[model samples]
Target chain A: MKIGIIGGTGDIGKGLSLRISDKHEIILGSREAAKACEAADATVCTLRDRNCTGLCHGASNEEAVRDADIVVISLPFQHVAPTLAGINPTYLENKIVISPVNPMGKKDGYFFFDRPEEGSAALAIQKMLPASAKLVTAFNNIAAHKWTLLDEELDYTVAVCGDDAEAKKVVMQLVSEVSRLQAVDAGPLAVAGIVESITPLVLNIAKFNGLKDVGVHFG
Target chain B: MKIGIIGGTGDIGKGLSLRISDKHEIILGSREAAKACEAADATVCTLRDRNCTGLCHGASNEEAVRDADIVVISLPFQHVAPTLAGINPTYLENKIVISPVNPMGKKDGYFFFDRPEEGSAALAIQKMLPASAKLVTAFNNIAAHKWTLLDEELDYTVAVCGDDAEAKKVVMQLVSEVSRLQAVDAGPLAVAGIVESITPLVLNIAKFNGLKDVGVHFG
Candidate 1:
């Protein structure tokens, strides 16, 4: 499958490219296409160092959305609206869009979920896309630093939430393809708030416990 | 430490008695003293059958709180306020109070966190208690059915949250005494909403994925 990351220069986008480019064609997209190219090159170099061949290339954000079967909106919650607006809406129509965006704020060294009026980041992002776009929420709770560590496995549980059943299943399959990530369907998009909020919870756990790179697993 | 359970007839109360009574004196308290005694007897009987000696006794809710140093409010969200109101508030003064209570509701076979105006159950319950009482949120995400199954190991990560640092550590120590349960300090009471919301998220994962008694772990 062809996967495009909107904020491809970011940690999550670059990390995804490094992790899955061997199995899927990754289009690393950015506003500045040159930066995306740099990130894609870094991903390729990192994977090659580990005796792995990765297929990833750089593109403008619009071109990335225009050409991919699945699009990951890898930007922060605040930037998602403007980034999506800049892209052509028609390009995203009927395509599966994955959101790992979590709306959160830190206060007194503790993080809390800054939930949007629409309830969750996925719900809010759903309104910014074309009516036919399928939005699925996954990978919201992963630790940021853990993403670039290719030597370590992402042995975590990804709770996938979407209104569309087919798109949800496809996304869950994609999640399981990553390193040791088990995906569980967490019901419809309405439940995305619960999943998104977990990121802040895990962050707080890491902060208070003197732990590092905390991620969640469900059993 | 003498640990008291406010709703001693419940699954969590019975489970706590069976699991920790050997290490700590468990004062099982119920609205009906007879029911509390029956539950205590059952716990002792169950533990004795497995060659595990459990120290547990039944009492009225007031007596339990009056005699114990630590108290676990093992009641449902709706029942918490009224139950606490019925008891003398002085009994809970300077006591370490644990709340595994999660405010949630079900709609169309999906569970959601019914977050209170005070942000979380811990915060709201804090208002009901004396200023010296140390409140900590733990065991909110554990599956109730799993608690009573002595054969199964609760090898799950428990996110413990509280404003009081010393009290949080004490609770984390108690949590580690349970069957393979690892406790992570999840920051202050302000982060309790995130910890409490995981219950509904896990329930949704279990329901949509055709799994049973799903629990969370953090790594």
Candidate 2:
């Protein structure tokens, strides 16, 4: 599968590229194509250090979306609307767009879910895309630093939610292919807020308990 | 410590009585004192079968609150308001009250968080309590059936949240005393919705993935 990750210069994008590029073609995209290319090269180099081959390429965000079977919007919550607005909507039409975005804010040295008026980030993002776009919410609760730690297994349960059944199944399968990740169908997009909120909960737990990079497991 | 359970005839109240009565006196309260007494007898008998001593007693809901240092409201979300209304507010004043209630509803064969207008059950229940009553949320995501199964160890992470730091600390310590249950401070009552919402998410995960009694572990 050709996976396009917008804002692919970040830690999550880099980590995904490193872990998944060996099995799937990764189109790492950024606002600045040159920076994405540099990050892609770094991903390839890092994988090659372990005597592994990484099939990763860099492109402009629009170009990346234009050429992939699935799209991953790996940008921060605040950056999502502006970035998606810049992309041509036709590119996302009928495409499986995965949102790993979590809307969160910190207060009094603790983090809280910055719930959008639309209920959740996924619901708000759904309104911004084409009607035919299959928006699936996955990978929302993984700790940011844990993604880049290639030596550690990505052992976690991913709660996936989407309106489209086929799209959800495809994303769940893709998620299971990652390092020790088990994906469970968490129902429709209407309830995606519950899954998205877990991100901030884990972050707060890590901070208050003096733990590092907390992740969730649904067993 | 004298621990009081408001809806003591249910699975959660029974489980708590069985699990913690050896260490603390458990006052299991129900709308019908007779039913609570029967349930308490059952709990004592169950513990005795395992060669353990159980200091559990039964009382009316109001009597339970009047007699305990800490109170656990184990009632369903819809029943909480009416039940609390029936009890005199004076009994709950200056008490450490715990809410394990998760407001959830099922639709299309999947469960979703039915958020109360006050945001979460904790916040909503807070309004119904006396100003001096210290409200804390803990054990919101435990699988209900797992609680009654004496052979199984509850090796799960419990996210506890509250406004009063001292009350939150006491609740966390209580949570840690449960079987292999580690408690993490999840912040103030404002974000308890995020923690409460996980109950339905886990139910959906268990149903959709063909798993049984899904539980969460934040690592």
Candidate 3:
């Protein structure tokens, strides 16, 4: 599978590239194409040092979106609209889009869900994309810092929510391919707020409990 | 400790009566005193059949509240207002009150969080009680049906949230005493909405995935 990651120099993008590039082609996209290339090179070098082979390349966000089967918006929730606006809308049409963005804010040493006017980050992002684009919510609840720790296994439950059944299945398959990560179908797009809100909940849990990198599991 | 369940004929109340009555005195309270007594009797009989000793009794909601160190409001969200109104306000003063209530509804066969105007059920209930009453949220995300299945262990994470630090600690201790349940301090009472919303999310997950009684764990 060809996976394109917008804001590909970010922690989650770099982590995903290193973990999955061995089996899939990764296009790391950034506002500056040179920075994306640098990140892609770093990912390749890290994998090679471990005696592993990986395929990764870097490009502008628009170029990445134009050439991939799946496009992952790895940008923060607030940056999603402006970033997507700069890219041509035609590139995203009929392609599977993944949203790992979570809107949250910390106050008085505690985190709270800063929901957008559309109820959740996913719902708002859906409005920014073409109507044909298949938007799926996954990886939103995982601790952001944990994604870059390649030595650790991500054994957490990812709740996949989307309106399209086929697109959701594809995203669920991608989620399961990650290290020990189990994906469960968490109903349709309207349920995204619950999944997105869990990010801040886990953040607060980790903060109050003196724990690090907390994630969720469903049983 | 003397623990009183306000809606003692409910599933969660009966489950708690059966599970912890051996260690603490359980006063099961209901609007219909006879129903509470019948449920308390059933719990005692079940425990006796398993060669377990339990201490439990039944009374009116007001009488139960007047005589307990800890009070659990196990009623549904809609019933909470009327039930609490029927009880004397003085009975709840300066006591540790636990709200396991989750406000939710199903639409087109999918469950969504039906948040009240006060933001969450716990927050809404906090408004109805005296200023000295310590309101803590626990058991919000557990599957209600699973509570009565005595043979199965509830190996789930219970996120306890409250503003009162000491009262929150007491509730967390109580939660840990249950069957293999881990209690995590999930910040202040303001964060209760996130915890309560998980109930509907899990319900939708179970329904969409064709699974049974799904629950959450934070690790």
Candidate 4:
């Protein structure tokens, strides 16, 4: 399978790109061609460091997903809507689109988040994407650092939610490919708001306690 | 010093009870007599396991703070006002009242916290407690499991917020005794609302991943 990660140059994007590269042909997409190439090269270096046969390439967002079976949007929460608006939803035809964005606000000495009433950022994304696209909300809960550091034996879980069941299954498979990680079905897309909001909770714990990287592991 | 833990049988109460037992006279306060006693006994047992020496006793909420110099209120968000209302404000003179509470709600498939327009839960708690009482908000972000686990070095930073500078110093000393922790002054009591709301963020993260024990640490 060919997988394209739009905005694939971030900490999370790079982490997922590294893990998925071994099982599929991976591409790192960015608005800036130079950044896309840098991200792709960095991911390949990371894969080589892990002694894995993972492969990654660079392309523009459109070109990255052009021939891909799966396209993962890994941009910041604030950027999701406008980024999608710029893309031609028609090109996303029948392809699975996954979003893992959370809203967080920190002011003065307090840290909190504002959740969209439309539910989660994922649902908002799904609503905006073309009807032909299979939208799923996932990877919002997993810590990016955990992906890069922890080996395959540790039991980490990621919740995947989407209106379409078939699309969710693709995400579940992708989750399982990353060693001991499991994908839990947290219902449909409307619930994606809940999944996205959980990030701030994790962030708060990390922020208050001086923890650089923290992930939530369910009982 | 005589320390009062209102709602001491609850999760946060038990955690702090164990940590402070060695240096102070700890009193466990709960709505139920049996539960309060049970909580006191549990803390003693945990202390014994760690080979720490301290004294702990059980009492009703009102009786617990009657003669104590410091009072720690570990009640839930909704019960805070009513619980404190039952006590005599006269007994609160010159005492330090500490609060740690977070309010959360579930919408669709997501979990989020409800924030009052006035700001964080801590600010609300301070408003409810007597003005004569020194109010401080700390330990709201620390995970209960981490507080009790001796094998784990505390990896989180706790932010302390309050109006009384002297009271903040007292709470910081208590926080320091626990080891592997740092106390950061996040400003006055009015800003406490932000600090207290982080609990919902942490809870949401745990809920999404189905995690039992999750905590935050600041850099």
Identify the leading candidate in terms of DockQ: 3
The DockQ figures for the candidates are: 0.87, 0.89, 0.91, 0.09
Writing each residue's lDDT as its tens digit, candidate 3 over B1-219 gives 999999988888888888899988999998988988999999999999999989999999988899999999998899999989988999999999999999999898899999899889999999999999999999998899888899999999999999999999999999998888899999999989999999999988888888998999999
TM for chain B in all models? 0.99, 0.99, 0.98, 0.90
Compute the DockQ of candidate 1: 0.87
For model 2, report DockQ. 0.89
Per-residue lDDT of candidate 4, residues A27-124 (tens digit):
88888768989888877887777787677888888777676788888887788778777777777888998787776666665445566656567767
| Model 1 Cα lDDT, one tens digit per residue, A135-219 | 9999998898788888889999999999999999999999999988889999889889889998898888778778899899898
10 residues in a row with least lDDT, candidate 4 chain B? B210-219
Fraction of the true interface contacts (Cα pairs closer than 8 Å across chains) found in each model = 0.96, 0.89, 0.90, 0.00
lDDT accuracy of residue B125 in candidate 3: 98
How many residue pairs clash in each candidate at the backbone level? 0, 0, 0, 21
**Per-residue lDDT value at A210 in model 2:** 93
Residues B148-188 of candidate 1 have per-residue lDDT tens digits of 99999999999999989999999999999999999999888
Candidate 3, clashing residue pairs? none
- The C-alpha stretches of model 2 lying farther than 4 A from their native spots are none
lDDT of 2 by residue, A79-184 (tens): 9999999999999999999999999999888888999999999999999999999999999999998889999999999999999999999999999989999998
Candidate 3 lDDT for residue B148: 84
Off by over 4 Å in 1: none
Ranking by lDDT: 2, 3, 1, 4
Whole-model lDDT, model 4: 0.73
